[model samples]
Target: MSKTVRIPRRSRAGILAAIILGICLLLLLTVGVLTVGAADAHPPRLVDNAGLLSQAEADSLRATLDQYSEELNFDIVVVTTNTLDGKTPRDYADDYFDYNGYGYGANRDGALFLRYINGSSKEVWLSTSGEGIKAIRDADIESIFDDMEDDIRANRYGAAFQIFAQDVRDEVLDYRSYDTIWIFVGLAVGLGVGLIATNAMRSSLKSVRQQRYAGSYIKGNSVNITEARDIFLYRTVSRVAKPKESSGGGSSTHTSSSGRSHGGGGRSM
Candidate 1:
């Protein structure tokens, strides 16, 4: 026969409270770990997967990108990879961005520059999402690529990347200042209109003077009159067809492997 030992009422209550506290602490720790892990997985800017950059180079680039991205309220990502994992430059770039969750704001406004170096098939791909697509137009991107082409061809990888970053920063900033740009345009238009009106008024005054002179039917002391003559050596007329202004500008978009829409363009160097 065994006798059961009964715990005190206060002791049981204390034990229950201790267990509850322990569970709460465990839950908090798990949450903390998860949050940190997520942050680590998604770097805000540069992702040098190819291990091409030295530690110092990577750190500096990452720092610069962080500051620039924050200022623009957009994510500018640079990814370098030796192999595109059997995907084309554009597809890899888009998937890398979408999968890793890089971007800012609700629409994930961001841009990506992917350097794919697979033996002789090296290339750079630029992709944009959300507002980023609107910020950098296709023509603007081509121009930037042209600027970096020489550096890339010379194997100056770091310099080429830096140029890319700088150009993107400039283009994005210019896009943001559209309002100020429009203001300047408006002022220019107003000035042109004013000039045209003033010229017309001067022409009218000249016409009135001519009419007065015609009414006289005689030469004034200040005027020299000669026999009227018509010289028709040649008759010439000019016509200029107005240019059809293009209404198209901005990145061309497509659906990525991850099913997210992206705008981008790419070229080989």
Candidate 2:
């Protein structure tokens, strides 16, 4: 005979309570770690060192950048300065993005729009990283600058920054859409070539003539039909709209001062 040791009911309840508490604590710790990691992913997106924007305007622009960054899963930043610290527009923008830790993901996926105001001369540079390099092409960067050119000239800093943020979001989201347009264009060209070849083959067949009725296929008095009926079958029609032209040329990249590859363009205002 063997005697079995049983755990008391209160002890079992206490053990269950402790396990539940431990799980809750573990979940809290995990959430906290994730929060900290997210915060470290990208630094402050808007740095108006030149004081180009008012307090209210800065807040608004920052909010817009934050919103777009979250939606695109890529950092969008704006920086303004009175001087570039003796570096060229491109070098300054690239260095700012790299040294300030202002990007997301391992590859530092982000875009930094830098406005360097020196006296009356204004220069802007767009610096792209990781996925931003592919999403924003040279032509796309030019278009973005065009969109902000008028606003910036008019001293509408807030409006210009908003446009920059919106355009960046649009370009990133529609980057693959440009490729789709090319696919459509290729399909249309192939279809046209196919039709032309088929027409040429048909034209070469001189022995085949157009027949007005089914009776032309049968020999004279060889077959007679007692009754004839026409039945309707389903018909399918497919239509593809023509693809609109896209202005996306392609991304051009260069090695930044940090040895990291980047793609972008610059404009003078």
Candidate 3:
């Protein structure tokens, strides 16, 4: 003989509610872990080591860099340090980018804008890797420095960084615009226009009138399709990525002190 033990309705309901609550809690925990991992995936774009800019300025600059980096597929970083800590400006910039986990792709494509503000040794340096190196040339970097060195020397850090960001964006865009597809497209369009114009001039000597509809000049009785149906065979959608422009060995580069290859230029402000 065995006793029949049964759970009450209220007890069963409480157990079910507890189980549902437990599942929900587990789901929330899982989502939280994923969120943290995603947030940790990327390093910050703007690191004001020397605290040159105010909080608002840093925030604004960081937002701009973030937007451009995503749009261009290359990280744009800016760092300001009081001193190089005994490293050359180039080495400091390169190592900072390499060690801090910046860059976008396998070659760690990124550009670093460094401002060293040590007394009597104020300097500006640009370090580029991968696509950034291909897009920004030494001469272009020098031109950027020339345009903003005065502001940097004047301790207008905010203004200088803004100018740097704008100039770099322009340079990268200009370089990427030189893809071969653009040239071929331009030539094709020009030839097509010329042919169309010549043909139109020749046709002007003949008689032709623009017809609005296919049935306008047709006899209705000649067409005798009694039934019509459209059958859908398939649907196809195609996508073509923009072609990446070749560097063509334009930019000069060298191995940084960190043993990573980089292209850039620097000058004392």
Best by TM-score: 3
Give lDDT tens digits, candidate 3, residues 128-177: 99888878887788888988978887878888888888888887788778
Screening candidate 2 with a backbone cut-off below 3 angstroms (N, C-alpha, C), the clashing residue pairs are none
Residues 1-269, candidate 1: write the lDDT tens digits: 99999999999999999999999999999999999998677565777777777887788888878878888888888998888778899999998888887888888888899988877888899999988887888898899899999987887767777788888889888887995799999999999999999999998786455445554875558666687887889879999999763427756778998878888899887
1-269 per-residue lDDT for model 2 (tens digits): 99999999999999999999999999999999999998767678999999999999999999999998987789999999998888999999999999998777899999999999988778999999998998898988999999999999999999999999999999888976877898999999999999999999998998999899988988998887899999989999999999864435777788888899888899789
Whole-model lDDT values for every prediction: 0.84, 0.91, 0.87
- List runs of model 1 lying over 4 Å from the truth: 1-41, 179-247
Angstrom error of the Cα, residue 45, model 1: value is 2.5
Clashes of 1: 0
The lDDT of model 3 is: 0.87
Ranking by lDDT: 2, 3, 1
Candidate 2 residue 190 C-alpha distance from true site, Å: 4.9
Residue 150 accuracy (lDDT) in model 2? 91
TM agreement with the true structure for every prediction: 0.62, 0.65, 0.68
Best by lDDT: 2
TM-score of 1: 0.62
Query: What lDDT does candidate 2 reach at residue 122?
Result: 83
